[model samples]
Target: MQRTRHWILRRLSHLDLILLALVLLLLGISVAVVASASGQSPARISGHLVNVGLALSLMIVMANIPPHLLSKVGPVLYVAGVVLLVAVAVFGEIRNGSRRWLNLGVMAFQPSELLKLAVPLMLAWYFQRNESGLRGKHFLIGGALLAVPFVLILRQPDLGTALMIGASGFYLLFFAGLPWKIILGGGVLAGASLPVLWGFLHDYQRERVLTLLDPASDPLGAGYHIIQSTIAIGSGGLFGKGWSQGTQSQLDFIPERTTDFVFAVFGEEFGYVGTILLVALYLSIVARGLVIAARAPTLFGRLMAATLSLNLFTYVFVNMGMVSGILPVVGVPLPLMSYGGTALVTLLLGMGILMSVATHRQLNKT
Candidate 1:
């Protein structure tokens, strides 16, 4: 029995079992919450489960990839993402006044999702190559690399995805030790450009910001989502009304209850206690990812792991804030908890890359 245990441990030494456990726990919670939120829709639950399966399969595959091979392919993946984004601009299908998806005969796909991983991967690879002497000009080059996809996705009018992708790249640059003077100067310029930014916002986008400031102004219109979500959350109290028993969701008052507002569903069903548990699980995953990043042997591995972890943090923070009415609705989904295949798959792939970094380093050390 001792020899068997030792053999198993040696075989699985590369895996971050704690992070894997956290991921599984979150996925379990997501499946349950999605089932409750979907109500009578059995297909929704099955589809979500299928997505989880596919995502997990991909995660395992990516976790086994060698670090050097990933570095070599990073630029290729990024270039592919850029090409897809351009294709969407020229020959994409329009949905609800936004050209964000490309219909490829059998299926429609969003290119912006690809940038979420590719941007960070490419940036990490770039900085890894220039690790010895990164200067102000190199930072400028990095910003330009970040801006191209950011602008393209923003043109797709997917502000949420564009911002998410841009944030991932920015995290790498910041982690690469960008100077404080540049950070302060950029902050000042961003503040000065506020009016210009407002001018560029679409009417609906502007309305979202206004609604965030004063949701009461359009309670039944623009502010309806926030109002209903908050009501659901507040009514759940300390112990909740019970699984699938929330009146707001069952009565069809909460909007987007399965996607962006799914957290609200979980909150209403399981209340404050459940929310605390879920948040802790999320933080554990983030913390574990950071530990892996800190232990990474190569600069590329460290940057990628850190950026991916922070990007996960951004998703959780934005989704919770949007649902709780603290931030403007940006359609950011709660990582792992939201019922969307694209975002879920992209996120899992990133976590897999982090796992790859950790495992690859361990294998090299052995």
Candidate 2:
């Protein structure tokens, strides 16, 4: 009992209060959005609350792990994530025209979410192991590892998640000190491959790109969501319409209001001021994450932490852009504010790993 108290005190001192406060603020905002978006669906709100509780518990557990242990386990976790993704490809349940979830009797799991963390973990471990002097071969091998799971996820036709995973891995490569010329060359190659990739996209995928090019062409078809979302955002003006009072959401003009389109709901009800405040909260989280990454005790910790931080930013950017019609509709959720068990869990787990890095740095500094 005495030893337990001592250990608790030692670990508790490392907690990042600012990050936690921002997280809680986001949670508070999420509850409001979920309630408004769900309209009388008590079940969804309850489920989200439960998921948040579970995720927070997991974050606490992750924060307790030592940096050395996290580094050692990174590869193991990565392999496990990859194996699960493979299993999902072979024997997964298909939903909404995509085979992305694995049923575990009681609940469904998305392995792609696991890859968001695992990719960074694996890359961090690899780069740290080979950090003495990286080379072209090392970059090639890293790209291959990232491409394997990315290809598998893309085959699942979950473009949003696949893109996130790819970004997470790419961040590690960038942080590993890859040359600017190589990076530019890779970008040029990707741009050149667009035509080939376009030829292979599914019908709906093609429609989305087309809609993005000219949203007014199909006002009631592929363009309905963006048009509606844009209206909601514009109507909010500067001060917003007030909570639970946005006509677009209240009248059900916005599809996926509680999920992908929640940001629209937020914009309609809270307006530009609300949007700015929300952005500030996200910015705070990102800033804290960068600090943790910069002060991380080792190369692996720094890479993993930075990748996770940037990945969170990508989630915000992509989701907001898609809902606003600046980007095509891909089913990316707005981090904690969106209602989905799998996404909430994945987000919280990523935060856990970030907290783990932050905790490690604090311990070492002491």
Candidate 3:
């Protein structure tokens, strides 16, 4: 009986209980907010539950796998992700004026989701392989690798996902010892080229920026998202309108409330105080991730963990900024709090990698 119990224990994931519990709590919050956003639609709520369930299961499976094995898989995953991005550019479906999804017969999905993990892992693996003697050209090669996917995703016109991917790669590169001179130079160059880049933006994308600057310019058009979301948030005050009692959400004034703008629903229903707690929860999760990154024994583990943690931070920051009328709405979801399968799965997969990094080190020590 003891032997059988031991075998069962061996098969279980070495999950960081704190991380697991925090994410689960966040997921729970997501369901409640999604319920309010969807007006308690049973189908939407049930479908969201299915997605969360499936994503959590994947997270557990990924957590059990060691970082070394993930390192070996990084290059292959990166290659596949790039190939799919190219395929998406060539034969992807056009939805909401963006060619981001590829039809796989069984189901259609955005290929760019793969890059959320592949980019960081690939760069970490690359730097680790060349760790003994790194040089400028190695950074160049890594930049080139990062650029290919970025350009491909950019061509798909998904500026949000593309920029997020770019940010993740930048995080990985920075951790892999990318020099600050290049970072500064690149920033200056990017600023100088803003006029040139503006021409490349889609009309709607350009309008989003314009509306962000002055939401009243097109109150019923491009400016609607910011105007409505801010109203919802402000109306909530200290304790919020009380869950489903939010006027903006219940009346359907907010767009994309279940996805990109879910944070608005949260802000309205929970208020400033609620949002504070939410931010604290998010910070707690990031704090745990930083601990894991700091403690990981290998460069690959450390870089990957740090990148994932910061990427999650990016999600929270960008989404809040968008909803609060501070930044242009880039359609970034609010991490585990938003309802979506692809992004949710990608986030969970990254957390799984973090768990592997956290636990496998202890396993080796034992």
Candidate lDDT (C-alpha), each = 0.90, 0.88, 0.92
- For 1-366, candidate 3 gives per-residue lDDT tens digits of 999998657646578889999999999999999999999999999999999999988998899898889999999999999999989888999998889999889999888999989999899999989988989999999999999999999888889988999999999999889999999999999999999999989898999998999999999988898999999999999999898999999999999999999999999999999999999999999999999999998889999999999999998999999999999988899999788898899999998999999989965454
Q: Each prediction's TM-score against the native?
A: 0.95, 0.95, 0.97
The candidate that wins on lDDT is: 3
Best by TM-score: 3
Q: How would you order the candidates by lDDT, starting with the best?
A: 3, 1, 2
Model 2 segments more than 4 A misplaced: 1-11, 362-366
- Candidate 2 structure quality by residue, lDDT tens digits, 160-246: 889989988888899888789999998999999999999999999999999999999999999999999999999999999999999
RMSD of each: 2.7, 1.8, 1.5
Error (Å) of candidate 3 at residue 23 is: 0.6
Q: State in Å the error of residue 210, model 1.
A: 0.6
